[model samples]
Target: MTDAPWSHDLPWPDDLPPFDPFDPAIQADPYRHYAWLRAHAPVVRAGRADARLYLVSRYDDVLAGLKDATAFVSTPPGGAIIPGLLLMLDPPLHGPMRQTISRAFSPRAVNAIEDAVRTLVATHWDRFLASGGGDAAAGFATPLTMGVIATVLGITIDDAARMRDWTNSAVDFIATRIRGVVNPDASVDSYAAMRAFMADAMDRAAADRAAGRGRDTVIDALAALRDEDALTADEADGFACLLFMAGHETTTLLSVNCLDQLARDPAALWWLRAGGSPAAFVDEMLRHRPSVHRVTRYAARATTIAGCAVPAGAPVRFLIASANRDAARFPDPDRFDPDRRGAPHAGFGFGMHICMGSWLARLELRLMLAHIAATTATIAANGRRVPVEGGAFATSGLTRLDLSVTRRSA
Candidate 1:
């Protein structure tokens, strides 16, 4: 047992386990830990490693709490592992910000991009095929999705590297809180750097709006918000900073997850070739390998969830990964069934903080998957497992996905 990866980091109790997230024991296999929580402390009152707060790991309980906005506030400056990001904002404010920017993600706006997105997807896959195969996560996954986000924001892929750096550093700080450890993401320098960049962008967008230029850019639209007094200079910076956060990482993680699934099940290629909907495929991929393992909530007032008591101002993680895999809610919870038709998985999340970028995410994934399956004849493999990196608490995933490919006939 001592030799087993699971043997070490035996169990997390009143306090969080020591912050050795890179331990092969936990990463090589986390199912045991998940299973333990599922069976034992689904909604246990655990002490924070450095502070005290509640934790929720059960399916139904997590679902309920996520939707309960009155009892749980999202606006606390400290509740979030990451600060200044909109994910921490609760309603009446979080509500309107979502509604205002949601025009970008409206069903109509998403549908209008179908053709353009498809073209980008096909073009990227063609490039991938020419190379004979590469790390899809880097070469294909990131570019395909980030390109669209960049297009929407009126930025260039040449500039994406800088944004990725900022997003990673920001998320790193956020993860430290989830793991209850030193503040790795607490980079005052990053905050100043990010704030300066966004401030510049906002200023340019404002100038563009006054000139009637950059109409198609999100930056332009955001600048327009400033004119309407809908967003202040600081608020615009915060919002753009958050939008940049959403634009960079998640879709990249999701695209890799989708492609890797298709690669593992070679038959999926045929399924796609048969005109199967990429939308459905993306849904399944999210269920199987969600990017955000869990969403956190803090108690605004004392409340009980499924027999667990949480005090006022207590922080809790919704354990979204566990919720998605709950057998009671999902059929054959452990199995990855692309065709499963029933309840939706907790992939985008539920409740007040549901992901505002979800529709765009789905549209982007669908386009990319369709293009790859149709354009690439064969995807090559360098024979490496998908990389999953562990932070003190949060999981960093899909560092790279190595694959080779042959293009469809010109």
Candidate 2:
């Protein structure tokens, strides 16, 4: 791919070190590369010609691009537009759709489920602590997050496990698409299965509501909208699928990240255990080790990001991880300081497209951290820390984190 207006052959700063976003090594720990790019080439071209990508790394540039929805659109021109999938929508369509969806999946809905979520957290953590700890990601965080989102969506526990499996496939499919190497064969079947399941669930929700037995779950809410002609059936089903897919996985990673942090830093653990705010810790963790690191947008028209020119229709990869760590935005950017104040990190993104489920994710993290701090005396890593297979291009966190914890004395 051409390196923008810099030259036809070489990357910006001709002697720049080799950088490939898809490389497993780079993805395993991308901060070093992010730091290098932030310092030297905040905006540069990457990938091959057919699937060229423009990388934007600085905090200000990324924020600007995310806010200027017109300049950097969610979907490329002529790309397949999935109805009800808010992530791919922009402007006029996005605003009304989001507003409508928000009515059903509102903060009140999330808040109402707190007691149940807390109970769910306790059940999982109690078991984990009783076992003296195990794979925190799979044993605790994954199931816990899946359960919470499932409850919110009104999915039965029996189906929650299936949803978890389907979510994994969906996430893999999405990651492959972002890398310009979609594998329909590997993920399409599971994706279809999930859509069908959600459709059935929505149908059930609608039926229950008509019979005056509506449970007021997210499904019920969306179904009511559909019945009232407020949302198309396709939109309702698409939104339900998006909710499960987006809600479960990202929050799981964030939970695991908190566990990983507590295990690694005694001071952080002590602060939490000693009654320091889990809210503060969570905010810093989102910045220091965000579960999601990069987001893609298509350059709608010719534009310049961080002084680098981008051509119309070019694919732009905003290095959210890099932007969060930019010293320009955060003092001593490399260090993980829970007490961090001032500019908010791009962990949950920015502008209109900021994560819709961010409030829910934060609540999950804060509760999980607070519980761990209150019950555990010491938390330590018991084995290797495995990074998520896809790298940081989409979601990034531990796939397997073996933790050992000791309970506080009675």
By lDDT, the best candidate is 2
Per-model TM against the reference: 0.85, 0.93
What is candidate 1's CA lDDT for residue 196? Answer: 76
User: lDDT for each of the candidates?
Assistant: 0.68, 0.83
Give candidate 2 misplaced runs (Cα > 4 Å): 1-17, 106-108, 168-187
Q: Say which candidate scores most in TM-score.
A: 2
Model 1, position 283: C-alpha lDDT score: 90
Clashing pairs in 1: 133-404, 173-185, 380-404
Candidate 1 per-residue C-alpha lDDT over 1-410 given as tens digits, one digit per residue, 9 for 90 to 100: 11111212346554435323345455434544655667666665433355554546567888888888888776443433342356776766677767776653435445556666777788777787788877888788777877777766766677656776777676665445544557644765665677678778768877876776755566666667766877676666667777778765777888877777777777777788888878888898777677776676778887777666666776776767777777778878787777788876778889878887787788888878777776767664665656666543444357588886777786
What is the Å distance of residue 17 in model 2 from its true position? 5.6
Candidate 1 worst ten-residue window by lDDT: 1-10
Q: Candidate 1: lDDT over CA atoms?
A: 0.68
Writing each residue's lDDT as its tens digit, candidate 2 over 72-107 gives: 998876566676789888898999999998989665
